[model samples]
Target: MDHTNKLFVIKLTHTLIWMFFVAVIFYVVYSGITGAINTYTWLGIVLVIGEGIVLLLFRMFCPLTVLARKYSDSQKDNFDIFLPNWLAKNNKLIFTTIFLIGLVLVIIRTLF
Candidate 1:
């Protein structure tokens, strides 16, 4: 591949990594807003905002995206394969954990 293609691959990989993080953030907000807004209460609104902040913090401190970027950069020649697998396997795990946490929060909110 040419130099331009290599740089494109790198940039594309970075964009994908950022996108995963964005999706996670969106999921958190979606879960929070959907759950809490349905109740139509002040506490629920507060919780929604709280969850959004938590999600932002989680994204900020997350190591998985950093690792993914590193993995992507290392495989510019074969990045198409590497980036997807990294995002699919590792990113899925991380997002699943967040979803589970969201589930737990939903349950808690429902119960009390």
Candidate 2:
């Protein structure tokens, strides 16, 4: 495909992946808050942790973002994804805080 098409595909894929992770994160939080920990909760936790490792391996950049960089010169934060610019800019901070809170709740629920 052409560069434009390729970039669009990347952006779409990235947005879908972001949505999946958002669901997983919220599920984890919900499970923790409701004290309904189960196999799915553990699976979601593992997936989120794996995502964190991948980000670390990529030096805190999503691999898709790096790949998308080759296609566009736009400096906007949401250039690689369908998120709002402000949300894209602070995506990591926002999600990581939410994830941490959920994790803490999970730990507390599990231990208590």
- Name the candidate that leads on TM-score: 2
Q: Quote the lDDT for 40 in model 1.
A: 33
For model 2, name the residue pairs that clash.
Answer: none
The 10-residue segment of model 1 with minimum total lDDT is 74-83
Candidates in order have lDDT scores of 0.52, 0.96
- Which window of 10 residues has the lowest lDDT sum in candidate 2? 98-107
Supply the global lDDT for candidate 1. 0.52
Model 2: residue 48 alpha-carbon error in angstroms: 0.6
TM-score of 1: 0.33
> For residues 1-112, what per-residue lDDT tens digits would candidate 1 score against the true structure?
7655655665566567556554644555465546652443434445545555754777843343444454345533234333455564465456546655665666666676
**lDDT for each residue of candidate 2 in 1-112, tens digit (9 for 90 to 100):** 9999999999999999999999999998998899999999999999999999999999999999999999999999999999999999999999999988898899899999
User: What does candidate 2 score on TM?
Assistant: 0.98
Tell me, what's the RMSD of every candidate?
Answer: 11.6, 0.6
In candidate 1, which residue ranges exceed 4 Å CA deviation?
36-112
* Model 1 C-alpha RMSD to native: 11.6
Give per-candidate clash totals: 0, 0
Model 2 misplaced regions, further than 4 Å? none
